[model samples]
Target: MSGKTRIALVTGGSGGIGRVVATRLAADGMTVVVHYAGNPAPAEEVAKEIAGAGGSAVTLQADVTEPERVRELFDAVEQQFGGVDVVVNTAGVMILKPVTELDVDDLDRMLRLNVRGAFLVSQEAARRLRAGGALINFATTVRKLALPTYAGYAASKAAVEALTPILAKELRGRDVTVNAVAPGPTATPFFFKGKPQEVIDQMSKAAPLERLGEPADAAEAVAFLAGPARWVNGQTVFVNGGVI
Candidate 1:
């Protein structure tokens, strides 16, 4: 590694998978910019934790779906860290419902965040990431499983999986990788929000591993794609314990 440390911008780092990704990258010695959309408390705590552990971190906020706010976010990162070498976009919302049962607003919200928001983030990252950079988008194993009540969410993430490789090719000789990490049912507040034990148990048994994935497990994959995995561009690396 060179004396010049790498910089990372982890969107949605306020909590869950994003927070873990930020912390792990910091441990890898990259100065991380933890991004949040609304509240900054969780992000601030994350930054403090990173600093306390001898890693460098700073918290920033932006609306992932909006272009101007996203631009402002990259500006903040540039001013603070010189340039970004890794961009792990974990900012998204998952609203599950059967396609027939979903209201227009529900579908709209999911598409805006999961699809449009990811596009906007990729656009900015493509424009700004320095050489040897990476852009890892988030997808879910549900797209592969085709389970009930995930119609809208699955469709949006499927789009993410589809576009990721093309983005990698677009970057051509830039040496920036573009990939998507698709995690199985992870044990997090977002995953357990309203499910009963039986439903959770059923899901737990659905995967061959018979357990929900940990957020840290997915983070490890992202860390790999961000650093030293230059040949891993343009693919959806499934972090789901063989959950086909």
Candidate 2:
């Protein structure tokens, strides 16, 4: 922490877990690259908060599923921050549907964003991340729970988990660690939106902790993996409060 300020790139910095993770990394002394796909306002707000707190941050927009956009994102980070020390892929879309009823467009959208997007961003990060830097991808507890309506979404996250070990091995010589975090039933706006209050309460109580996970809860795990946890590689740390 005494050398050059670390640089962290967090995809989907406009939303729940990503926003919290970016802010926490800034607080931890990393110069943050807050990346958003379509929403710049919220991303800028997160960066502004970091700046107000005396931390350094910038916002970049990229559709990570597109290889060219992903490349541009890394280039912008390099231009601004000099080099990247940590990369977090938290940009994702979830469309819940039973396999038989799943829309083809929705399936493709999830695959493109959750799987292809993650791979592209991770590849770029792997190329640029310094030795001792970390690459973190966001997965989901649905991969384990196999909930009825989440087949496609879970399949995509399962791909992410599959890619984690391969990327870790690919980056082994560089001393760059790769891992995934799977969070369950978080109390993010996305989770509570349009859902019945009773259903939300039931889901919250299902976890052993008897509460929905918070954005800060997952961010804590991301922060740990980003720093001072070199031994934890190619692993998926579940931040589900023992729901699974």
Encode model 1's per-residue lDDT on 163-230: one tens digit a residue: 89999999998978999999999998999987889999988887788898999999999999988898
Worst window of 10 by summed lDDT in candidate 2: 187-196
Best by lDDT: 2
Colliding residue pairs in candidate 2: none
> Model 2 — TM-score against the truth?
0.97
- Each model's lDDT: 0.91, 0.92
* Model 1 per-residue lDDT at 130: 90
| Cα lDDT of model 2 by residue, 1-244, tens digit | 3387889999998888999999999999999999998868999999999999999999999989999999999998888767899999999988877899999999999999999999999999989998779999999997888778889989999999999989899876788999999999998886777678998898889898899999999999999999998899999999999998
Off by over 4 Å in 2: none
- Model 1 clash number: 0
